[model samples]
Target: QPANKVFPHFVPSLSGFSLTSEVKTQDVEYDVPKANSTDGKDEVLFGAEKGWLGTPIDELNRMPQCAPPLSHLKVVPNHTVTVRTDLLREGEVPVPYPTKFKDAWDDVSVKMPCSEKNLFPMETEDGGGVQSRWELIHTALQGGFKKRSHLTILLLQCLFFPTLSSLQCLELCEAQHLFEVVLPAMVSLALSAPRLCTLPIPLLKSRMNHSLTMSQEQIACLLANAFFCTFPRRNSRKSEYCNYPEINFYRLFEGSSSRKIEKLKTLLCYFRRVSQIRPKGLVTFTRQMVNNPPNWESSQTQLTRLHITCEGTIEDDGYGMLQVDFANRFVGGGVTGHGLVQEEIRFLINPELIVSRLFTEAMEYNECLIITGTEQYSKYSGYAESYKWKESHTDETDDWQRRCTEIVAIDALKFRHFLEQFLPEKMVRELNKAYCGFFRSNTNSKHLSAVATGNWGCGAFGGDTRLKALIQLMAAAEAGRDMAYFTFGDAQLMRDVHEIHTFLTGRKVTVGRLYSLLNQYSSTVCKNCRTTRPDESLYSFIYQKVSSQTATDALKVISDGTDTKNLW
Candidate 1:
C-alpha cells in the first residue's frame, strides 16, 4: 500500500503548540548592514577626516529609474517597471536602448511630471514646504551634528542634488561650503566613474530571458533618502514599512565603534561607486510560486540527477542555477539582526533582495521568492560577526549578464522540539514547500537548472541535518529536478547522504514507495522509543525498514563500516 494509505492515522495536526513551543519577542536591535533610522541618531555623515556626513550618491541622481527617457514607458504609475526573470531569446522585446547617460536623462527628465506647487502636505498658507522639509532633515542629524556651524553646512551640502532647486534661495550659509565643499565633492565623485548611459544589450539579452530594468539614478535617490534619514513612515513599532527590510540609515548611526567606522567606509565606497559608474546592465526581481501546485501524496514526478559535495559555498559553486536561500518565515531572517547566517550573507551580497520585504508579507509554507540580475557589492571572507566587507566586487557580465544570478527563497520550518519534525503531516508540509520551489513551470523546465542547497535548517532552526537532507531530496525527486547538495563543511553527511541516495537509487524506488516507507518507519520507530531517544539514527532506522530485510548484507556492510568508501 502507498504510505498515505497505510499511514492515514499518522497524520498529526498541522497546527498545534508542542511542549517545546515558546514565544519570543526581541526588544534588542543589532547594528548590521543597512540599519538606518530617522531619529537623528543614525546620521549618514561625519566631519572632515572623521566626518560621517552624507556623501553625494551620484549614481542615484544620475540614473533615476523613473526619470525621463524611460519615464514615458507605460507602467503602473509610481511603481517601478515590472518584468519577468525567466530566460528569453534575443530581440524578443523591442525597447529603445540609450547609449549615453545624458541622452537618457534628458529624455526621461522632459517627461517628468511637473511637481505640484503644494508638494508637501504640511505646507502652511505660505510656501513653507521646502523650509519645513529642510527642518525635518536638519532635525534628523545625529545630536552633535545638529549644532549650528555643522548643521547649516550639512543641510546646504545635502541640497546640492540638482533636482532640489527649491533650496537655492534658502539663506543657510554662503554658497562657499555648498558650492566649494559639497558640490565639488558630489561632482568629483560623479565624474570619477564613467556614466552608465548604455545598456549591455547583447549581454542582457543573452543571459536572462526577461528582467525589470531600473535607472541607477533612481537607486541613488532612494539610497540618498536613506542616507539623509528622510524616509517617512519607517519608525513606528508597527510600521507599515515593517514588512519591508529597514532601509533608512538608522543602524549605522547607533554606534561609535571601529566596526561602525569600517561599515561607514564601505557605505561611502558604495555611494562613490553609484555616483561615478553607471551599471553596464539591468536587475530583475521575480517571485516564483507555483499555481495549484501538487500535494506530496499525489506527486508522481521522478528526481533529476544531482552532485553532492563537501567543501565550497553555495554562491561560488552554484553560480548559475537557482540557488536556495534558507530563509526565515518572514523572509530575509534577521538580516539586520545581530546574529548573521547564510541568509544574512545572501542578503548582504545581493542587497537588492531586501527590497522584496517592502511588498512581500510573511511567507506561507508553499510560497517561494525568486530574484534575478542583482549585483554583488562587497566581498566578505567569514560568517556572522567575523564577517567583514573585504573589498568591492566587480562581477563580469558581457557574454553572461552581470549579476544575472537567480536565487529562490524556501523557508524551512523551525521545529521547537526536534522530534516534532518526525510527524507525517509536518513532513508532508515540508515536501510541499520544497516541491513548490523546485518545480519549474512546464515552459521553463527545459531551461531551468537544478538546485544548490546545504545545511539549510541545520543552524539556528535546530533541525536535524539528516532529516532536512532527506526532505530536500524527496522534494527534488517529486519536481523532476536535479539537486547539487552542499554540506557546507559537513564531510560526514557528504558520505552518509551519498550512501543513502545510492541505496535508494539502486533499488529504483519511487517517491510514493519512499513515502510509504517513511510513514511506516516514523510510526514504528516512535512507538518503540516513546520515552527515550532512539539508539539508531533516523537514516539507519529508515534503512532498516526499507532495505534491511531484503538487503541485510548491505545493512551489515554499512554497519561494519568496511564498505563506506565506495557506496556510490
Candidate 2:
C-alpha cells in the first residue's frame, strides 16, 4: 500500500486567502522568439560601429543558419545577417509570450504570430487568446542565469511585485517610508485579516483615519509599471581603441528609462513582507520559497555555448605580427540549449518546491542538474526513480539524466579533423604563399606563419576540444567564402554539439524535396592533392576543368542537418 494512501497529505488553510487560488485577471504582453507567420515591412539597417536597431526583429533582416565553410575559406556575415543575443536556433521552437500590446512599447506591436521581436503586447488577433502576464512574468522569472535565480527573481520583483509578507528569504522593511499615506492602510488591512502577518501595522492605523481604495494586486502592478527602470553600463574606452564603442550586453535595461538602477533596487523591498513585528522594536520575516530542500544533485546542470569570433594573432614570419589585439567583449549569443527549463524559471520555486521541480523538470528534459535541489531529493530518497537507480526499466527521464552529464563534457577531436581539410598539400609552402602577412595566434610558430594564434586564455570553464576545432575552422574559414558547408553523419552528436551545426548548418534554410540542399565553397579542391582553388565556381565541370582537378567525388560531409539551404 502507498504511504500517501494511508496517511493522506495535510492540506494548508486557504480560508484566510492564498495567492495560489486567487483569480485576478492577468495582463498579457511579451512575445516569444521567431513566431511571426505573415511578413511585415522590413527595415534596411546600416552597418556602423554599433549594431542595427529596428522595430521588429522577426521580419526585418532576420538571419538563417548556414553551412560552415571549409577551414581555408573565411566565413563572413552579409547585409542580410542579423545576430542578436535573443537568437532562435534549429530544433528550438518559439512560443509567444501572451501579453497585450497596450502593455508596452511604442513603435511595434504584436498581432497574429509573434516572437521576442516586438515589445507592445496586445490581445491575440486569433481572438479568445489564452495569453497571460503571469505566464510571461513567471516564465522569464524561472530562467536562471549562471545558475543564479536570485538575480532574475530580484529583477522581476523590482519590476512587477509590490508589498507581500515575505519572498523566499528577503526581509520586508516595515519602518514605514510613507508614514502618513501607508500607516492607516496597513492597520485597516490587518484588522480585516488578523491571520495576515504581512500588513504593516502603521499602515492599518492610517487606513482607519483615511480611505484607501486600491487592492494589493492593483497597487503593486501600478507601482511596478510607474517605476520601470534600467541600469546600463557606460560605453568603455576599449571601443575607442578599436573600430567601435565598447558595449556591454548583459546590463539590465527597463524600457526607455536606462538610468534608474538604485531606485529599482529600493523598490524590491516592497515585495517582501515581515512575518512578525515586536512591540519593543523587533521585526520577524518568513521565507516564501519552493518546498524543496537544497542539495548537491538538484542544482547541477550542463551548458553549451556556441561562440563564433575572429581568431589570428599579432605575430607572423612575413609581416612581423598580425597585430589584432583581442578583448573579451562578450557578444553574439545563440540559444544553444532548451530555453525554458534550462533558463530562468528555476529561480521562482518556493523553497520547499525547488527540489521536486528540479528533479521533475530534469526528468522531463532527460537531464538532471547537479543542483542542491536535485541532490537533496536524491540523497533523501536514495535515487529510487533515477535512471542511474537501474533496477527498473529506463524511462526517458533516467536516460536523459544519465546522458546530460556525459553530453556536457567536451570532445577535442571532431572539429580538428574538419580543420585538416583546409591545410595545403605542402604545409610550409602554403603558409609562405597563401596566408596574409597577418595571423591571429602563434603559440606554435614553427608550423603556421600566421600571427595572433597564441592563446590569450581568459575563459574559466573547461574546453571542449571539438568546440575548439569548430572555432578553428570558423576562424580560418572566414576570409574568402560568402558561404560554407560542413557535412557529417546524421546523428544527435552531429546536432547537440551546437556550435558546429549552428554556424555550419542552422539558419539560412529552405526545405526542399528529399534531395538535401547544396553547399557552395566558392572554389574547388583537388581530390588527389586536396588543393583548394581560390576562384569561385557554380558547377563541378567548370571548377575542375579550369582548376585542372581530378574527378574524385569525395564525400561532402555536411555537418548541417539534411533540412537546410543558404544563399551566399
Give per-model TM-scores: 0.63, 0.18
Task: Tell me model 2's lDDT, rounded to 2 decimals.
Answer: 0.21
Put down candidate 1 lDDT per residue, 46-121, tens digits, no spaces: 2222211111111111111211332233334322342222432233322223423321112122111111121224
> How many clashes show up in model 1?
34
RMSD of each: 19.0, 27.2
- Candidate with maximal TM-score: 1
State the C-alpha lDDT per candidate. Answer: 0.51, 0.21
Expressed as tens digits, the lDDT of each residue in 1-568 for candidate 2 is: 1211100111112121111212243332222122111122332322222121222222211011111221221113211111111332222221111222223222111111112221334567675444443334334433433222444454555344332212222212222222222322322322222121122111111001111111222222222322221111112334211221212112223321211221121122232221112111111111111122112122221111121112111111112212121111111011111111111111111111121110011111111111111100110101111111001011111111110000010011112333242333222222221122122122232322122221211122222333333333233332221111111121222222222233223222211100011111212333323433323322333333422322121112234333223222
Q: What TM-score does candidate 1 get on C-alpha atoms?
A: 0.63
Task: Name model 1 segments beyond 4 Å from true.
Answer: 1-217, 256-269, 398-402, 531-533, 549-568
